[model samples]
Target: MRSYTADYVIVGAGTAGCVLANRLTEDPNIKVILVEAGERDRHPFIHVPAGFVRLLDHPTVTWRYHTQADAETSGRAILFPRGRGLGGSSAINGLLYVRPFAEDIDSWEQSGANGWNFGNCLPFYRRSETWTEGSSPQRGTHGPIQVSRVENPPEICGAVVQAAQKAGLQFVDDPNSDTRGPSIWYYQQTRDGRRRSSAARGYLRPAMGRSNLTVVTGLQVSRLEMNGTHVSGINGTTSADIPVQIRATREVILSAGVIGTPRLLEMSGIGDKDVLDNAGIKTRIALPGVGNNLQDHYVVRLGYRVRGAGTANERSHGLALAREMMRYVVSGTGVLTYSAAIVGGFAQTRLATRPDVQFVIAPGSFVAGRIGVLESEPGVSCGVWQMRPQSRGHVHLTSSEITAAPTIAPSYLSTELDRNTMVEGLKIGRRIFAQPEVARYIVDETVPGRQAETDEALLQYVRDNGSTVYHAVGTCRMGDDAMSVVDSEMRVRGTTGLRIVDGSVMPSITSTNTNATVLMLAERAADMIRLPMAEHAASTYSKESV
Candidate 1:
């Protein structure tokens, strides 16, 4: 067996892992090792902003975990694609950057996650961001991640923005600001013009050149090697099935994301005892919350057929492609650089205090599980997602063997509240499409058609075809409760020198995309871990004095 050692051993170099590696390795005295199950992020398509359609499902860059038979969707198994590379899901995401609402973070504090409220986390969010649209007090321009606006948006995208204004919603230039209710705005992407700016490209790539950081690819961590209540090391296998052990001098941080992190904990005998006993493994910790509280956003595509020449089909063929390519090559301004989802906004499905649904307007039809249906048809597609869902689910070990895939249960639409919200979101979508400004571009509804107008019909349609927005979180939730898997500082409960810093640690799901929040959490985790012992002592003394 091969053996290695480091001051910090980070499992799974995805979004969080990359950020942690970059921050921790900044100090030459701290030796950091980042292990990833997949190969390096060298694929060409991964750098293209619009190539996410293919990379989202590519097994080489994605973990490709599927959910168990969902109760709400008539036993349909949903595809959960997690990033398996150096940058994690950030490398293959839609790149719609959004911070959670203040209410969402306040809920985390209410759920026992101290020091994680919006007021406390706002600085961290700004710390990791580098917005191209210039600096604001709410946004940072010197951060590693580059966030920018779409240069040239489609006409329909603009119409949606107008429609949102006509609907009496606020139109804010920066949606991540303090004015955080409902708004219409141009989508912000993590791109430098046409090329993608992933966490690996922005953060990890620069840090990898340091002498103290070691990045190991194609290493699947099997279990945590613990001595009593303290974690000693991690055991795993290389791509060639070679056994290896990585001893951590200080800590073992699991940045393996929602699916992989909880799965690792369960495999290491730290989950619910009943689950471990069934898998024939000796119980060590028996934390029931290891794989509970699963949450994600589900979206139903609403497609429309255009009446005239204002669609992607007319702009994707022979002469059109040539003209656009020339313009794009000469001035870096064209439709090829960005995805069809140019304009999107948040809105309340009902007259509630908070926005419960989000809509993304794409100038192209994305159907058949992202195979891009109706490419030849002159139409646009709108995706409606029910945010802040009440439904919860779980993840569990399928077998004691490390090589076996874990069982995932997302339990989408498991609650009546979730169903009601989805149905209401569909109605809201119909209202937007029926508006005079938006109605001009549409000839007919190609998805559910005009027949499915009532609540029951919409509910049935949602149950049959709703798909995940690819934002899975809370499998290793952090809190002070008895069932909490990790604590507020991200340290695993009932253990020493073991921590989980990923989307899995989110006590509750954020109302927006999770990539930005995950990266920010990783940044905060790195800072917390890197604080000098003297500083920790001083801070503790100061708190006591207060």
Candidate 2:
């Protein structure tokens, strides 16, 4: 075995892992090894803001896991694409920068995750990004990640904003500031100039210069190396199938995301006894919550055929695309710099007090039931989803092998409230489109057309058409409960020197895109692990002083 050692071994050089590696290594005395199963973030498309569409399904950069076929989804397994490279999903994700509401994290504290309320987390969120408008109480200015709002959005986006305002939603200058009640706003992108500011670019690259940090890519970790209840390190193999062993003298942190983390735990014999036995592994921790509590934002898209306005579909092909390429090269602007959505908002349905529904508008439309492939005709697409879904699912290893795909069951639209909320959210989308400002575009609802009018019809349409928004979370949930996988400090229960600092540790799925929260969570986790050591050192007196 090719052996290596570090004070901290971090599995998965993803959103959280990158932040942890950067923060921990700042001490210079701390050594961190961040291992990624996928390649480095060298793919050309991974840098461009709009290149996400290409990387979403790219074989090299994404792990195209599919949710198990369920009755709620009309018995069809839905594609769940996760980034596989250094930045993980951050590199392949839509660059929209959204944060969860205060109430979202407060609920985490209420759910036995002590000291995890929004107030305690805001500073870490601020520490993760540099907003375009500079530092403010509500924004960050000196962070590694550079965030900017969409400037001079296409006319269709303006129309959508007007339409949303007409539909009883107030337009906000910064939706990320106060995302409560009904509101519409332009989206901010995780971009530095024309390039996407993935976690690798924001945190890892800057920290790579540190001699204490080591990044090993293309090393697929199979299982943890444990000495009784304490995690020692990890065992894995390189891309060439060369056996490798990494020893962690201090700790082993898992940031392999929602699906990967739990699966890793199970593979390492740290999950439920029944699951471990069935998977042909001996139980180490007997944590039943390792792969349970899976939650994701399920969305249904409404496509429209437009006439008066030019959409990305027109500019994505022929001479127009050539012009866009030139525009991107020269002025660093054009359709090539567009994010997954130009306009997005949050609004309340009858289901909840805060915004129960979220909306995202793109100045282009994709084919029905499939994304990435734009329609030949000019069109617009709006995706709406219930922000807080009650539906939960689980992820389990299909085989004992590390390379085998897990069985993920999202159980989308599995509840009455979820179904009703989705129907209502879809109605809100139609209402926004029906406004004169937007209706003047003379676009007809193409997907679940006007023919699907009743609630039942809309509900049926959602069952057949709804898909993941790529925000899977809450699998290895953190709580002080019996079924909780990790504790408030993100340490695995019944285990020593092991922690999970990713979205999987969330008590529940956030009310918005999870990347921002994941980044903040890592920042906080690093402090939790380091601050105590600093305090202990500071309190110790020298022999002369004593």
Off by over 4 Å in 2: 535-546
lDDT of each: 0.82, 0.89
Quote each prediction's TM-score. 0.94, 0.97
When superposed on Cα atoms, how far off is each prediction in RMSD? 4.9, 4.0
Candidate 2 lDDT tens digits, 415-462: 999999999999889889999999999558898888999999999999
Error of 1 at 485 (Å): 0.7
lDDT by residue (255-326, candidate 1, tens digit) is 998899988998889999988888877889879898999999988878888775376656666798688778
Off by over 4 Å in 1: 313-331, 368-374, 533-546
lDDT of 1 at 538: 20
